[model samples]
Every structure is written in C-alpha cells, then in structure tokens.
Target: MNFYNIVRVSVVAALLGTSCLPAAAVSPPPARTSAVTNEDERLLALFRDDQRREQAIDPLGMLYRTGKSDPALLRQVFTDNPVRALNKSVKLSLSALKKIDRAKLSPERQISYDVFLYDKTEEAFWLRPDMLALTQVTPLDHFGGLHIQFPSLMAKGSAVSYDNVADYEDALAVDRAFPFVLDNAVVRFRQGLDSGVVTSRLTTANMIAQIDGLLAQPIEDSPFYSPVRDFPDTVPMSERTRLQKAYFAAIRDEIYPAYRRLRAFLNDEYLPAAREQVGILGMKGGPGLYRHLIEQQTTLPLEPEAIYQLGLSEVARIQREMDVVRKEMGYGEGDLRSFFDTMRSDPKFHPKTKEELANGFSAVGHRVDELVPLFFNHVPRTKLLIQPYPAYREKYEAGGSYNQGAPDGSRPGIFFYNTYDLPSRFLTGIDTLYLHEGAPGHHFQISLAQENTALPDFQRFGGNNAYVEGWALYAETLGYEMGFYKDPMQHWGTLDDEMLRAMRLVVDTGIHFKGWTRDQAIDYMLSNSGMGRSDATAEVERYIAWPGQALGYKIGALTIQRLRKKAETELGPKFDIRAFHDQVLMSGALPLPILEAKIDRWIASQKG
Candidate 1:
C-alpha cells in the first residue's frame, strides 16, 4: 500500500462519505447568505480557496512519502493550521444553511441542503466540547514526536524529498490532521512503551526477528513476496535508486529505533499509568471520545451502547439463520461450531496456486457481472480487475480488498487477492467475495461516488465505514438473488463469511472495549467461525490495533438489509430491486441514517 493510500484511508475514515463529485461541478463557491455579512463570506471564500488549493496540490498530504525529507516544505504545509481553516469553513457552511429559506431553494439546492445537513451533523461529533481540547493536543504531539524520532527521515534533506518518500505519510497525516485523535494514539503508544508492559528490548527483538525472518528467505521463495525488480519509469533512475536506498535505510535506522523507543516507553511508563477498565466508557472524557469516533466514522449520533446492543441482536439473528442453513445441508445433527469446522477443513474448497487464486477471482467477477443486471440498472462504468496483493503490504492487507482507482481514470479499481497463503484463498466463497469486493459492492459504490462531480470535494472521496462496508456486506446477499449461489457448499461460504463478520462485532468490542485479552478474542473467533488459528490471531490483533473498524462491516450490512426490507414492505408490488439499488448507489455513500432517509424517499417516489 502506498503511504498516501494509507492517509487516504484515514481521510476516508474522517470524511465518511465515499463518493467523488462530478468534475463539471467542481466550480466556485455558492452565493453568500444574508445572515452572514460580506466580510464573513469573504473570509470563508479565502479559507475555501486556500484549502482547496492545498487539497488539489496535496490531497493526501504527509502520506505521500517520496523519501525526500524537506523540512522547509513540511513546515510550510503544517504551519498554516488546517484545523483553523476547517473550523472557519464549517462555521460559514452552517451560517449559509441557516440563512437559506428552505422552502424557496430549488430541488437541486435542496439536495445540497440535505448533504450539508449530514455534513454538519457529522462535524459536530468531531468538534464536541469535551473532545476539542484533547483532539487539539494529540496531533501536535504526534507531529512533534515523529519529527523528533525520525529526524533523518522527516528533516529537510535530499533523502526525504518527494522522489524518495513512500506514500504512507498520508496515513501519518491522518493523525496529524486530527491532533486530538493522534494525541490519544501517541499517549497510548507511549504508555504501552513506558510501563514495562511492552519493553523496548522486547519490541526491538521482535521487530529484528521479524525482519530477519523476512530477509532469510529469497524473495521468490515466499508466496507473500512480490519483487519490485525495477522502479516505475515515471521515476528517474537516479531518484529511484536513491529512494530505494533511503527507504531501506530509514526502515533499518529511524523506524526501527523509534519502534524500540516506543516499546520501551510503553513498557516502562505508559502501561503503569494506563487504566484497567475497558470500553470508551471509563476513560477521561470517554463519552465524548466515543461520540467523536462514531461521528467521525459513521456520521451519526448513535451512542456506543446502542451500537453494542445492535451487535448483540445481529449476532443472535445471524446465528439462528446459520442453524437453519446447517440443517438444510444435512448437518443439523452437529452443532454450528462443528459444522463450521467441517466446512473449513474441506480440501475441495482450497485453491492450489497463485494463478488459480487469480483465476478464481476473475471467474467470480465474470459470474457477478452477469447477475448484476438483475438488481442494478445504474452499474458503474468503472472497470474492476483481480490481481495479487503487492509484495510490501501483503502481510497487512485483509484476505482481499477493493482498491478504488483514481478519479481521472489513471488506474482501474483493483480487487487485490492475497495469494500469499493460497489455501486460505478458498474457491467456495469466491463468487460472493467478488460481489462484495468488486462489482455492485465496494468497486461499484466507491467508483460511482468518485464519478459524481456534483458532490463537494469533501463528499467525493470521503467514506463512512458503516455505509461503505455495509453496502458491500449487503451486496453479498445479492448473490442469492442473482442465482449465483447454486452450490449448497458455495452458499455455506457466504454464511461462513457473514458469520466471520458477525463474530468480529462480538470479539472486537470484547477485546478493546470489554477488556477481553487478545487470546480471549482469538479463542472466540476460532471457536465461532472455524477460521484457522493463525488467521484468527492476526484478526484479533488487527482489531486491537484498529479499534471500532471491524464493527462497520456487519453493522453496515444489517442497516442495508433493514432498509431494503422497509422498502419492500412499503412499496409492495411497486418495489423494483434494480431501481432500489440504483437509488442506493446514485445517492453515494452516506451515514446509515442518511442512507435510510434517502431510501425512504426513493420508496415514496416509487409508490407515487
């Protein structure tokens, strides 16, 4: 994964709206409101212009590591204070909305109004009084810490120049962009290092061990490795070698040392100060932090308890369905747990090689494409490609992921299959996986958003996990409707995948929020989903490393299912699945509530 892509991931996390605005609509700001004076409007305009320029120049700032560290440029970019600019922009937007005579606005403006309302509501979650102070403190600390720790990599130098850096700066900037959240992460990282809970020596030893393990084998010998024998032609020869050398050196020197320091700090200092209690409920300003994350990720005011309860309900409901599916397959005599065990161990389901894995993915795309017309009329013009995971990040990416292409059509939307462990890439679930990760799922929805020029820049490339992932999850079910899941065994794969997601809801919260140990979380996943122990452990660790993310998949899927059901009941015979799907995709990715509202309006239109 490019570093910039990581930052894009974080920004996508913050924006929560995952659709691109149409290019034609990327124009000047709208007229000023009467409630706000010309001066305010002028200030707002300046801010918007400056920010837009910054966005256009470096949309994924700090995340694009070209390996060239120019301190002067870095200082200039960070010095302007984006938070202040964003604050002013948010205020001006709200003022304009307030001044609007809602009844007088044209229908098109009304759509903007609806979008603005959603944006305002979501922003409030991030700027809540309790969170503002901490949020501000955190980003500064992260920036300061990174600068201090990796001065060689981040300082002004030939090495840190654009040509040499990796794009991961975007991910780093995500924390920087939101100081409050970044501050918390820094505090957590530091604390984890300080209290002897995680010793520097141990972390260094582990990292070195991992690195050595990586170096011990020839690149071709590891299934996970993809050798980048030559740099892209886009990069000059001299710059490419320089960057490659700098990148490796930084990893060996700066990053490794920083990791060691952080580990020591966590082991010696932070953990001792760390609270024993679990969940966002017990931390200082816990309620506000939780609210901020919810708003930041989901674009809603839903309380943590409400989400937790929803997870519980979803788990029970899905489990019951699993039971029924098991019985239908003549496994009723065995427990669901035992049934999953049999399903996972069945050798008939496993793919044998990298080519087979890629071919399986391609086959799924072909099959799903045929079925898409059954449920969607406004299918995306964007193409989808199934490829193997890139070498550098295969260890970290999920089993498979859908990478949306650049808006200007520079790249095709890529569905990267992790052929790193081919056996793990089973054939049983390939069709459903393709549907969720490729057509009519992430690729379709995200690409449509990117293509929508009418949306604001903030909305165009933004993503809310619940909405985006939910839609994908919902897309999984479309397999049944499309008549693609003809094999009972394949249907079992769908259930297994669904069960894995449901189990994530239970285990993620259990580990991070409920104080369940890592092992405890792993055990729950293994026992519930029949996933191999290694995969289960990796997943549990991922949840710990990235809190609240796992909840999005199952939660989002359920919301879509609920909305579709509501549409069916209300529209009766009038409900057209294709039209309904079009409405969902055309509106772009929204917060769950906004999505429901949009769907309801669509249902009303159909009824009339």
Candidate 2:
C-alpha cells in the first residue's frame, strides 16, 4: 500500500469524535454576472487551482498522522456543493475514467481501480466523517491545520475563518463522497470473490466485524477526539488539558467500547462461519484475480506457483547466509534455531532504559546521515528526527517506523522507535533498522518524492509498496558499501534483517495460502533467524493481520538489486552508482515497471 492508503487501513477500524463548529451566519455572494469579470474569474480560478493542489497533497500528510478509512469527507470536499466548481473537476475525473480503455491503462492504475471497485464497504468506511477526521486532522496547521491555503478558500465560501471551516468542511466533504466510491468498489469486490482471486472469507468477516464495532462506539469516547478538536495540540494550557481529558473520555466511551463490540461480534458471528479451505483456486475464476494481484504487486505477469517458487528459492538462499554468520559467531553444529534463542535471551543485547534505547536510535540516525554523502550526490533537504513512539501506540507499532514530513516542509520526517519492551530493544540490529526506516531509506525516498514538483501528485507523494519497501531494503545494504557496518555484529544484524524479510516471503504465503498455523510461522522464523520471541510473535501477527504485505520487502529489494546489476553490466566501467541513485530518486516512486522503463531510458541516453 502507498502512504495515503496506509493511514486509511490502520485507522478505518478506530473510532473518532469532533466537537461541533458554531453555526456560521449566511454570507452575501460577491456581485456576479452570467460571465464573471476577468478579475473575479482570476480569483475563482486561483482558488480552484489552490484547492486541487491542497487536495492532492492532503492525503500524504493525512496518511502519516492518521489512518485513511474515511471516504465520506473526501466526497464532500470534492463534490459536496451542487453549485461548486470543484464538482466539475470530479465530473471531469469520471469522464476521464470512462474515456480511457481499462485494458490500456497501466497495470498499476488498473489494480488501484480494481481494488477500489471491489471493496464498497471498505470504501464507505474510509470516507466516513469520523474516519476522515481521524486520518486527516493533525497538529500541523498548513497541511491539516487552519492556516493552509485551502482553508482560506473554504472560509471565503462560509463566514467562518479559514482555520475553523477547513477542518469541519474537509471532514464533511470526505464523509459525503465515501458512499459513492464504495458503490463502485463493491462491484469489483464481488467479481474478485466470484473469480476466486481473493478467497479469504475469514479475513473479510473479521474486517466486517471490525467495522461494525467501530460504528457501535459513541463519538465522545473515540481515540480520534483530540485530533478532531479545533487546535489539536495548540489549545491554551487549560483548554489543552480539557481537550486531553475529553479525548480520553471519548476513547473510553466510544472507541474502546466499539472495538470490544466488533471483537465480540467477530468471535460470535463471523469466525465460526469462516471457511477452512485455502487459495483462490476454488473460486470460479480465482487464477485470474491472483494473476492480477501478482502483476500489480511484482509488476510482472508471473503465475502464482512461479511467485511461490521464487519465494522458496529466496528463503533457501538467505538461510545459507545465516548459517555462515552462525559459524562465524562460533556456534558450530548448533542449528540456526538455537542461535536465535541465544540472541533473544542475551542480556548484553538489551537496552537498560527507554532513554538509552531512544539515544541509541538517535546515534544510528546520525551515523546514517554521515555515510549518505559517500553513496549519492543528491540528498534530501528535509530534516530527520528520532523520537520514541507515542505512548498510546508503542505497544502495537513496528520495531521502528518512519513518518515522512509534509511536502510543504511544515513537519520534519520522524523516525519513531517503539520502546515498550526494553529487553526486546537492543543493539542487535538498530543500525540496520535506522537505515531501513530513517536516513537514506524511507526518509530519503519519501522526502525526495515530496520535493519533486515535476511529477504528478500520485507519482510524487504517493507510492507502490514494492517500490517504497524495496528501496528501503536496498538502503540497508548500502550501509556496508559505505563503510558504516564496521562492526561484525552490526553487519550480521543487517543480514539477519534481510533474512527475516526473505523468510516472510515463505511464511506469509505459508499462512494465508498454505494454511500454516500461526505457531508454525513463528517457529519457522525462530529456527531461521536470530529475532526475539516477542518480536517474532509480533511479526507473525502482523502477517496474519495483513496478508501479502510481507512479500513486498523481499520482492522490492530483489527487483532493485536486479536493476542495479543490469545497470552495472550494461554501463561497464563508466557506470556511476551515485548518478544511477540520483536518477532513481529524482523520479520519486513509481510502479516497478514504470521505474524499469525510466531506468532503461536513462541507460539508453547515457550510451548515446
């Protein structure tokens, strides 16, 4: 998933609440003729242009801070007013979609549409006002805050100031637009289900239960309450405290209760009804849908068995490397599984305190920045910050995560370290994690994408999972070539991480497609890699929660590796890795096929 969708996916199941804005007095319209004067036209034109620009960029900021499940608010912003000119733009988009040949569209775009079309309930849930408020509202003013340009336009239409109206209207518009998108999505979803491409009835039932639970919550008890308030983090000290109290009140009253309802529903109404059978093969046209997902994700037209086999080969290759590391660590004849246990239990690897863990991550961030110049000439102007994960989310966050800043530079890219379990936090692979999630990995690629004004909004601030995750994985290896992994243990940590991802290719498919139990997947990871039990358990649950996502890292990394090797061989001695990297970053993120096409063009130009 791209960054925008990531926020939507994460938050769709959560409850949120917002205070009602004071009603605005009706405003007199500016003098108008059948045709507006040039100056008036210019003003409206400028406003419309600004609105579209903000709309495009808004999703990026929204995804980072909140999840993306709200479509109702999106529809309102794009199409709420019957007389609004922006509604014309929505019509224009529909027209464009109709005019284009579905088959002729790029595979990535097609998959995007197909996914959207098949999942009406999800589309509706994503566009809901609460969902939009949860995902889009933030402390940053320019992007989600009141001072932003689009807010100014909305305020002009209403009597409220830009700041007050922006949040409410943006939220309202998204809620309105959500159902329309879901209507289209349901059509596609049924087709996929019938065809046997997406046969996970259990997953669907769980998702539905989650949504039902969210809907049951009272708005006052939502986790999203703080974010939806007028000045999320900037209320006067007294007001801030009030807001915080209200936020928790809402979480307890609305959000948690909703989650419990859904959880109970899943257990009572859905789980038992789920099927025991696996794979898309039983669906009428299952092979085709599976083909489409593979094509969309890998950007290749390989069959499921071929993709599965490719995963198997990669797993074997990474295990061999892990064995080499094991022997070097002097664990002769000790199976890889035992080594993983030793690494997990070793007190020497654990952090003494949360502060120490945060500082250790900060140090890794600095070290990565130092080596960045060695590998590439072009570097992002964006700043990076290493912070502990917010207290509310530390328990569930990945080991480390990168939240990219706004395209307009309102926020700095943040690398949030999860320090909930200190024993699980260690020096074992901190450097690799930093490189993968922070400097020269997500931060670099994402910031550069936001900085590129030349690319379309979708190409610039948006991305494919394969490209985003793949590039991050590739960044990990660069640490070695740039001389940052001087310590043998650190180097081994990098390989261990890589091995973990490769193993995912096997385990993800194993669980969802092959019916392997959760324990079996955890056991496989324990036997193959030196990860802590808590960490391994978390990773396994993540795959269970999100199928197919684990495959993206290995698939993406290997694709880039193949591309780099091809570039080196084709360019011979003249090939400069720095220049090649610049070319890659300059285009921002694209579908792998598009990236490959661009690289081929770059190579051809260099030859001439």
Candidate 3:
C-alpha cells in the first residue's frame, strides 16, 4: 500500500465508523424475478447511500478522494463515536446489499456485488468490538500516525485544494480540529495503558521523537501554516491576512500544544509502561489479533507459519537469482556479502545531492513512460509528479511512496522519494522503485480505478492490500521485460527489493509468532539484502507497528504471477499481456480469491 493510504488505526476506525454486527451475519439475497426487477438499480442506490454515510462520518477522507472542499466536513474532528456510527451504517449497507438478488443484476453489477461483499466483510471484521479494542486504542505510531499524515495531508497539492477564500477557511477548520484528534488519541492511549494493550517501547519512543520534531517547528514555519504562506489568485487578497493570522494562531495554540501534550504523555507515562517485546505476540490478545491481521491483510486464511515458510523459500530463490546477477557482473570470485559491502561503500551507487536523487527518479519515470504502451493498454489520464519528500516528513518516511491524484485530473499524482540520509540511499534500485511506486505501479493502479467512474465508489476507492501492493510489487518485475535491469547492479537492486518483501514474510512472522526480537529482525534484513541500516530499522519497526501488512506485497505478487503464468500456458499465442493486465486492474483491487476467479474466467473466455 502507498504510505499515506496506510493511515493511523484511528483514521481507519473513523473511516469504519460506529456500528455493530455479528460475524458472518450477512443474509442471502431475496428471491429474484425472471423479468429483471431492477436489482442493479437498487444496488447502485445502496452504493450511493453508503458513500453519503461515509462522507458524513469520514469527511476528511472524502475531501482527499474528491479534491472538493467541504467546510462542514473540514470543521469536524475525528471521534470514536463516529466510528461506531460508521460500523452500523456499513452493517446496514452490507445487509441491504445481500437483500438484492444477484442473478437479476447486470454482469457489471454482479462484479460490484462481489467486491462490495468482500470490502464490507473486511470492514466488519476491523470494526468488531474485540477487533477495535485491539487496534483502535493504540492509534498513533511513527509510521502512518496522525502526526505525520496530518502535515502531509495539509500540504499544498495534497488531497485538499487551497484555491479560494473558503478553501483557506476550510483549512483553518481542519487545523483547529487536529488538536481534538490528538486529544482523542491521548484518551485512546490511556485506555490502552489501562487495558495492558499498549504500543511497543520502540514504537512509543519513535513516536515521541516524531512529535518532538513537530513541536520544535515555529508556528508560521509549520506545515499547517503552509496554506497561509501561499495564497492563490482565487483566494481574495482581503482574506489573506485574516487566514494567515487564523492559521498561525491555530498552529501555535492548538497544534503545538497538542503535540507537546502527546509527547509528554508518551515520555512520562506510556514509555514506562510500553512493552519491550515489539511483536504482537506479547500484548493482551495479541496472537489472535495477529492471526486476524494476517487473514485481513492477505484476504486469505493464512497461518503465520505458512507465510513464514513461504518467505524463507522465496528468500532463498531470490538469492540464487542474485547470485546469477553477481556472476554475470564478473564477480564470480567474491561472496555476496562482500559485494554488498562494496555497493554500500561505493560512492557511485549513491546520489551526491537531493536534486540528483530527484532527477534520477524523474529519469526512471520518463523511461517507463516511453515503454509503458508495450506492456499496458491503459495509462492514467492524471499526470504524475516526482519529487523528494519534504524535510519534516522525510526523516521517518519510507524510501519511496506514491500519493494518488484526483480522478478528474484536478491534481497530479505524486511519487515522493526520500532524500534523507542521501548517501545511505541506493541509486541502483531507482528503476525498480519508480516502477513500483510510480508508473504502472501505484500511480497506474490507483489512478485507473479512480478514473473509472463506471465502477461503484467502493470498488473505485476501496481496496485490499494484497491486490494493491501485490500489483505494485509485480510491476517491479516488468523492469526486466522493459530492459531496465540489464545492468547487473540494477538487476541486483530488483532482487534486493524482492528480497525485502520475502524477508517481510519471514521476519514479520518470526517476530510476532516465533518470538524474534526487533534487533534480530533488523539484522536479518540487513544481512539478507543491500538495504542500509536506517532503512532496515524503519522497515522492521513499521512491521512491528503494523502486523501482517508487509505480507501483502510478496503474497499478492505471487498470486498475480502464478495466475499470469497459468494464463500464458493456457492461452499460448492467444495471450495478450495488455488484456490480461486490463482484466486484473480494470476491476479495481480485488480480494485474492476473487481476483484469481476473475482471471480464470478471463482465461476461459480467451480459450473460447
């Protein structure tokens, strides 16, 4: 999943909303009429109702998705009560969805019905009382926490537009609401502390540091103040001074204090109580939560051990491929460890300046654009922008991430490459990174779905990580077909990335299920790949903060790869790579089972 999309547990909880449902309580569809009773129309209406309810509960999210400012929505702060309401709404929607006879619906609506069921089921699982207790209580983390995401969300050209006077007012409302969200987080954390379901000490420390970083910034210099600094022509000149004062005051009085309060709480109380064991296995009811996360994330009933074993096997296989790349580079004599050392130390493999780093990614993107038609039949109409992460966010941010643009082409998709600790970052992986996070990866997958208005909003906007991240990981492999990995170092870079996903399978399970330490997980990552220490540490901690999420990349990619191989074998000369991709992507992100079934149907159609 893209970094920004992986929001805080609270953000997700708010997105899920207040509701209740028994597990597996969806009723079967009502009896159908042979004459066609307009079930598709009824289903479409239900989808529209669901979207309305979602906007009511998750206005901020809708603002991001649509790029339309709603002052009413922007004025509201996130609260747990809304999450409960959202749950009830989702349950009602699910029940209503099941009441429609699928047989009477059009084939297109049938696909929508299946995807809706899958999405609601997952939503219900996360919103369940027990599940919420385990997840929603410890909402903030160093990765994907509100403190980090809020700044990025409020930045210029982000989801929300800052174009007019009312737009600036909407931002002020949002700015004022942030403290309430932070306050709510404090309440949740305290509840977790009471219940003994607190975050890990490592995660807590990282979060405190993040909060401290935010607190240290001057009021006007804050990201929240960024909007005030740049008034557009549309924003009336008369309103500028007022908006600027309002923004600065909000940041100084509301935002900074909230950060400081949270920081103090973490350092004084939560830190002492935080668990040393970083894995979910150590917390109250953690193992069950981990198991649930595995199933939820991969959209399959996979055991941790099974995933771990798969990861191990994948790691070994990729290593062999790495050896081939090494040998081809005339490094037949030395061990991979030594070669990794050379790659790490070699100045040629690292960018000297941030500009050069940004240029490198832009070059990779342009090269992919030139070759995209050979592999993809569809490219998103929305433009893609490549730039380095802003300083405030770059510190703890992932190496690279893609934030999708507005569907109507109002905003361009952005691929933010990290320029932090530039020397530690590798240039070898630039091609693979661009392919995964930028073109034909997230930018393609997310933008295509958003732009396709024919699909229901849930199908267009909602997605499972297995298909989303899995498709991105699979996109990385196309580098080879496009000849981007001909250089042995570049080939190794792709393999190293593949190894990162494979190791996630093992290390994630090993930490949570097999009782691996944070250090052990980090060491395993460092030793197995050419990833720098900083990146390895951040990656491991991310898994700790969010269990079972990383599993999606390799697991999802493997499913897609296996299906593609099956399609190639079955269709022979009839197989069209572009068409197959369209089949996989055009439906939006699907659960693995649904995606596999869809591909199988496509293959049968090809055969006929």
For all candidates in order, the CA lDDT equals 0.54, 0.54, 0.80
- The most accurate candidate by lDDT is 3
Q: Give the candidate order by descending TM-score.
A: 3, 1, 2
Model 3 error, position 323 (Å): 1.2
Output the number of the TM-score-best candidate: 3
Q: Which residue ranges in model 2 land beyond 4 Å of their true spot?
A: 1-264, 275-291, 330-333
Q: Candidate 3 regions off by >4 Å?
A: 1-11, 14-37, 67-78
Give one digit per residue, the lDDT tens place, for model 2 in 134-158.
2222111111111111111121111
In the range 1-608, model 3's lDDT, one tens digit per residue, is: 46323341223534332111111111223334353348777987787777667666664565566544354443344456677776888889988987999988876678888988887777877777888778777877777676777787887778778878877776677767677777777887898898898889999999988887877888777888888888888987888898888888888887888888888999999999999999989999999988988887788999988998999999899888888898897778888877777777889888898888788888888899899899989989999998888888788878888887876877998888898998889988888998998988999998898787767666766677788889999999999899999888789889989999999999999999999999999889877888888889888988988788889899999999999999999999999999999999998888899998889988999999
What candidate 1 gets wrong by more than 4 Å, as runs, is: 1-7, 10-80, 127-288, 303-306, 327-333, 421-425
Task: Give all TM-scores, in the order shown.
Answer: 0.73, 0.68, 0.94
lDDT of 2: 0.54
- Per-candidate Cα RMSD to the true structure, in Å, reads 7.5, 10.8, 4.1
Measured with C-alpha atoms, the lDDT of residue 532 in candidate 1 is 60
